[model samples]
Target: MSTETPTPFAARPGFVADEATGVAAHYGNPLSEQRDLAAGRALVEAGHRAVITVTGPDRLSWLDSLTSQSLKGLAPGQSSETLLLDPSGRVEHAAAVLDDGVTTWLIVEATEAEAFAQWLDRMRFLLRVEVAERPDVAVVGAFAGLQGVEALAPNGLPLVWEDGWGEVAEGGVAYADEPSHPARDWTYRETLVSRDALAELASSPVPAAGLLALEALRIAAWRPRLALEVDERSIPHELDWLRSAVHLDKGCYRGQETVAKVHNLGHPPRRLVMLHLDGSDNVLPAHGDTVSIAGTVAEAGDEGAGAPAREVGQVTSAAVHYELGPIALAVVKRSTPVDAGLVVDAQDTAVAAAQETIVPPSAGAAAGVPRMPRLGAVRR
Candidate 1:
């Protein structure tokens, strides 16, 4: 689903480019490599990520006004994320942000880098901020990359933006309150490197992983990547993204009205769920598969007396976890019951799934009352 072509990996052997990112999809055995990486034995190629830099005193304050997160006080080396929403609050872009004193670094999808930089350039107004895309800079990811990030740092800005989705950030809300969240060990970090640096790593003694390995860990942790989870109708709440990428109390931003209205008064139209797939057929549902209850929808003038299967969700991403077997992350209607039995349509086959709720249906109704019209006064 990503438009990013993989960065050049000329020094790596046995890796093959089979995805849109053009990076290796696997180095022969993806499952074994998944285990190695999960056990902290490997690093994955993040050729799909792109880096952008915003320099000037106005960088932090200017970016704070344009995105969802509050970044006025973001200190150097602090990692965060921000979402650009359309006027309707649908997520248009997501950026992994890091401040390095003199500059603000934006780590975004390679496919989105140019456009994102251009957009920021146009938004700079009379501000001193200077936005630039760094095509010379590529990315590499590892769970323990932070400890060695200094060694991997490039000359100008050795940006190392840690992934903070594992826990709730300050001033954010958590919709998923599971005591032992499956992704508790999801400690991932990305390092910016020169093209030559990535090539050197490709030749290093350390083992390299493909896209599949990264995806398995991410899906198992219930993480939502914009390239995979976002559709035209996507909003931050549906993916439980408010837990990290959003600042609920942040002052007026482009889509703040919609964000507040959805959080305070209305429930998100849909919610995120983890699906334990019944891999009896050893088949995985591809992205964009329709999800329905485990039965068939009744059609008009239908002869069947029982209700027909109705689509309640869509499989956003699917993978085979080293521990969880086959699993998927899905976006379902909020009203879909938490205990509902689900089936994912994999073209010709319908794979069964057990639902694990992420964002509950009653998620935003904290006031515990029916919403009334704003213009009219309360009835006496």
Candidate 2:
């Protein structure tokens, strides 16, 4: 009684469909597949992603005027991402972008395809650009070291997009200044492939991984996904999205003023963190689960019988990593103590969690403007 369209890759052995994502959750052995994927020994079918194309001499400049990333000077075969925010500076949409000279391909979440394409079409007034979804096109993901991925490109131009999350992008700033950032080793890449190519791979010797493997690796790297991490109140600063999807020096856009003001004079109200969950119970916290201060629970234990733990944040994404065990990314109040022990409410049990800061409490106010003395203030 499911309405999900069957993926072309479903014919392979041990295929189990993810009811939520409409893609393969795993091919029987997820942990082994995760190791193989990290080792460049497998490929993952990202069929849950949608492809859109914009073509014309004005495509680059048109996009540059609207998104958070500067796209006017995008060179051929360059990979970048951009954010579309509401007028009030809340994140609305995001896409992985690649230009192949003749066309600019946008790879986005399948759930975002219709609305995103409709918005672009409505915005195209007398512009030379044309917007259309490429249903015939599909996305395949792999680590950077995977061999022969370049040959899968159409029109002799490589359509692979290598995300720039490992280092701070040009005209971008980092709030996570940890010396050993996990994103330092992130080398994920997504390539555009035709349906015929997908079928060919399904019948060939290329080993396949699934969404489970990819999600585990992505969570381990602390990579944020638009569909998972973004919410109605999300701002680029909260998730450290400015480090990749935002260009601080870009020209006027809908949310530019708020972005600048928060970065230079104010701090974000919330910060993103990675939670190291205790795996003893083997319970993984689901998205939107309430996160509470463990100290509050302990203090309540010292009191009479029962007391409620103080809510601190909410878990955004979670996964059981191949080597790291249970891990998750959560967004907590900026004032939450960095050293505070936390717990996630999972299946009626309090699972202990340790915080690894991704965005610090001190994030924002980048201009460092000196404070001016108030009138009639006494000098010490």
RMSD (Å) of each candidate, 1 decimal: 3.6, 1.9
TM-score of 1: 0.91
Candidate 2 lDDT, 1-380, residue by residue in tens? 02265676688899888887666789999998899898888889886688899999999999989899989999888989999999989999899999988899998988898899999999999999999998888788898778754334565687888888898888888899757788887888898878556767776777888999999999888788888888999999999999888999979987999999999999999999999999899899999999998867654447544666789899999998999989999999998999999999999888999999989999998889999999999999
Native-referenced Cα lDDT, model 2: 0.87
TM-score of every candidate relative to the true structure: 0.91, 0.96
Error of 2 at 246 (Å): 0.9
Worst 10 residues of 2 by lDDT: 147-156
Off by over 4 Å in 2: 1-3, 148-154, 298-301
Best by TM-score: 2
- Count of backbone clashes for each model? 6, 0
